[model samples]
Target: MLAKRIQPMVSQARRLYVELMFQVMGRALQAVSEVDDAVKKETQALPAGFLFEMMVMPNGPRLIVEHTGLGRLHYHGASAPRPVDLSIQFKHIAHAFLVLSFQEKTAVAFANDRMLVDGDISYAVRMTRVLNRLESFILPKLIAERAVKEYPSNLHLPHKLISAVRIYLKVATNFVETVRA
Candidate 1:
């Protein structure tokens, strides 16, 4: 009886956690594209109006991002008006939770068949790079090291610290504006 009662609560908690992570990640991506030269360059390489989405399968939380040209990215909350150019779907919410919680590296998850990609492989590659870069900015060095395939050796502590602060500030501002809207 206790197990049955706890299961639903655990599932709900995981779902909420994953949903929140996706929202923050979307904001972080938007902020990083604006603030990081390397991220901007990566976004610039994507076609104008390109849209990328990541979600858990079967009615799970999702995030969509668009390359709006001029080296900019826009987060479109849980849905977008335009069709997605690239979509990555996790097989299960638990799989998504593992990745979003930084318990499993994306590359490792891919290799383990925890997710599926439904678009151009090259574009997915580019998006992965952008995500890795964004993760480095928002996550602590130790956690980022585990989350990304490779932590950037060139990113020193001071620079990473400053960039993290800026990225976090932007994310917070975006959330506040979203609440207001």
Candidate 2:
């Protein structure tokens, strides 16, 4: 009985965390694309109206973000009925948080059997590149280096710092809007 009672609370917390991860990631992607031409170019080949999601297992929590042209990435509301083109589902909530917290790279996590991908492999690879670009902009150099396979040698610190601030500001604004809505 105690286990049953605690399970729901744990599930709720995991769902909230997963939702927050998506919100921050969506804003970071938008911010990076705005300031980095390389990132914009990387996303150019993605099919328009592509919807992607990272979800926790067993109906725990899901976040959907859509890629529109010109760096406009928007978080699709939980209630939105759009079909996801690419869905990365974590086998467990803890594993999902591990990737979100940067302790595990997405590719590494996938390779380690921590998650499942339900979509086109080619598109998923493209999306991974986009995500690596966003991490370069938002994460600290030390963390980004570990999270990405190859941290660019020419990525200047000052530029990265400036972009990080912009990404954080956008994420905060998005968070506020989400809370208000």
Where is model 2 more than 4 Å wrong at Cα?
1-15
Candidate 2 local lDDT, 24-142, one digit each (tens): 77667766766677877877777778888877787857767677876556667553457788987899888887888788888799899998889998877877888888887788889
Every model's TM-score: 0.98, 0.83
Question: Across residues 1-181, which tens digit of lDDT does each residue of candidate 1 receive?
Answer: 9999999999999999999999999999999988899988878988999999999998899999999997799999999887899999999999999999999999999999999999999889889999999888778889999999999999888888888899999999999999999
lDDT of 1: 0.93
Measured with C-alpha atoms, the lDDT of residue 68 in candidate 2 is 83
Cα RMSDs, all models: 0.8, 2.9
Candidate 1, residue 88: lDDT: 95
